[model samples]
Target: MKELRSQAIVLRTMPLGEADKLVTMLTREAGKVKAVARGSRKTKSKFSALVEPLTLGSFLLHAGKTFYTFIQGELLKSYTGLQHDLERFVHAQYFCEICDRCLPEGEPAEAVFHLLLTALETLEVDPHPARVARCFELNLLEELGLKPALDACRICGKSGGPFRFDPLEGGLVCAECPRPASSFPVSAASLAVMKRLLAYGFQKLSVCLLSPQSQSEIHQVCLGLFQHIFDVRSLRSLQFLKAGKPS
Candidate 1:
């Protein structure tokens, strides 16, 4: 069997027989991989903590017929701060889940890998989890080649001012253009925020502010576009997030 080593972020883990675990991770070089971590469930297992979701580490594995077998792991960052807040934790999970769903196995996803690492770091320091989540979503869409057009109207190709986001048409429609049945009114402030979020890097998100109305608009538009593009009925972590909200 061939041995491989790479930097990876733990995405999820499932219990195996008694002491083993099925660990899924996104590797910087190898993209998504599912490996069997023998004895990882045991208290004394060196990989016990490193296999938790969102933990960044370097992993050594052996190729098997169907899955990779974990040999050893060197921990990098555990991202333990996420556990201190429920909202943050849920958002982190949502991020991981989306990555898990979007990435294909064994395909190099360097951009996505880096984006996820940066997003986790941002989540730990950024006060607004919603903003981080939205930014991450927009970046992910771009990385996946599903970025919606925001510069001009999707219909008339007109530039400037109060636009309506039409997920079905895959972008904004100007005020002068006829609104599609599925279009929703989008304010200039929300459009500006969306543009900035898509343009700025994660490090600059801490200072970016959004009004409550703008936040709702961006959320609705992104979520609608995601569902329309990916055909994902729902995300479990997002459901958990909505359930925990004050609404």
Candidate 2:
């Protein structure tokens, strides 16, 4: 049997049989992996907490015919503070879910691994969780080769703003440029904020305060881009997030 040992982050977990769990994780060395954790469903199982989603840990596993079997794990980070906050926790889940959906299994994704780890670490203490999340999403999109051109109009190549974001066309469209029926108006302020979010580091994100209008615009743009590019109709975490909002 082949053994694999690496630092990994749990993406999600599901019950298997009666006492075991099917765990999905993103590892620094192996990208996304689905493994079975024996007896993890039992309260007395030592592996129970280690398999919780959003956890970072070092793990040992043995390859089976169909799946890898987790043998041991050492908790490296639990992000306890993040789990305590509902908004932050849901955002973190959204981040993981995106990675889980986008990345292929067994292919090494070191860049994405670091991006997610850094995002989680930043989300734990960052005053502006939304900025952190936006940055993470933009960076992740770039990593996946789906980055939208935000610098100028996708068609005209002009440097000025007051552009409309067309997710179907994958970039900004100026008034002079042929706009698609799917394109929607995006304010200059919101565009500037998105450019900054994509370029700035996580430590600097706390300084960018977003107005409610700009926030909604940015959210829709990202959501549209994600859905159009990945063919993902919706994210479960996003539904939970919307439901949690004050209506």
> What lDDT score belongs to each candidate, Candidate 1 first?
0.86, 0.85
TM-score, structure 1 vs. true: 0.93
Name the weakest run of 10 consecutive residues (lDDT summed) in model 2: 238-247
RMSD of each: 1.8, 1.9
- Quote each prediction's TM-score: 0.93, 0.92
Off by over 4 Å in 2: 231-233
Mind giving the per-residue lDDT tens digits that candidate 2 earns over 1-247? 6999999999999999989999999999899999999999999998988999988999998988888999999999886568788889888998999898888899999889999999998888877677777788878887888777888888879979778999888789988988799999999998888878777746568788888788778878878878875745477987887787611
Q: After superposition, how far is residue 31 of candidate 2 from its true place, in Å?
A: 0.8
**Per-prediction backbone clash count:** 0, 0
